[model samples]
Target: MTEPVDEGLVIYWRPLCGFCQRLLEALEVAGIQATLRNIWDDPEAATFVRSVNDGAETVPTVVVDGIVYTNPPPDQLVIHLQQA
Candidate 1:
């Protein structure tokens, strides 16, 4: 909700999204630094999520180095982070 990121990892989420919470927790445990964008709070963020999800507002959408991932598994996200 603060600012959108252009590099590294950006996690688009909503506060009430369970999957988002889970992913955030996983990132924390993995010591991954990611910019968090709350889609519910930012209309542009929601639109971005929709664009990447076939026009559906899917929370926990992750972007790394401009690459978008829709609801990636926690372990897979970690792997992506490592690759980033």
Candidate 2:
């Protein structure tokens, strides 16, 4: 059987994206601390982000441990964090 993805609460976001802004706000309100990687500052990261999402660099993609949450909501994200 295939093992489940274990994404561990790391968020990749862009400054211009409103969804990213909301996600950050939600994290703050929920008192959650997540490592954020901005694609603009790091060119290599932009490439890596694309690789993670099948060549589509989607903002607000979160990695909780190994699994990826492509645009996860705040409540769902909290639940995921609780699992860790």
What's the lDDT of the predicted structure labeled candidate 2? Answer: 0.76
lDDT, residue 34, candidate 1: 88
lDDT values of the candidates?
0.85, 0.76
Q: TM-scores of all models?
A: 0.88, 0.80
lDDT for model 1, on a 0 to 1 scale? Answer: 0.85
Candidate 1: 10-residue stretch with minimal lDDT:
1-10
- Residue 22 in model 2: shift from native, Å? 1.0
Cα lDDT of model 1 by residue, 1-84, tens digit:
323469678999998889998999999999998888888888889888887788898878998887788888998889867876
* Residue pairs whose backbone atoms clash in candidate 1: none
Stretch of 10 with least lDDT, candidate 2: 1-10
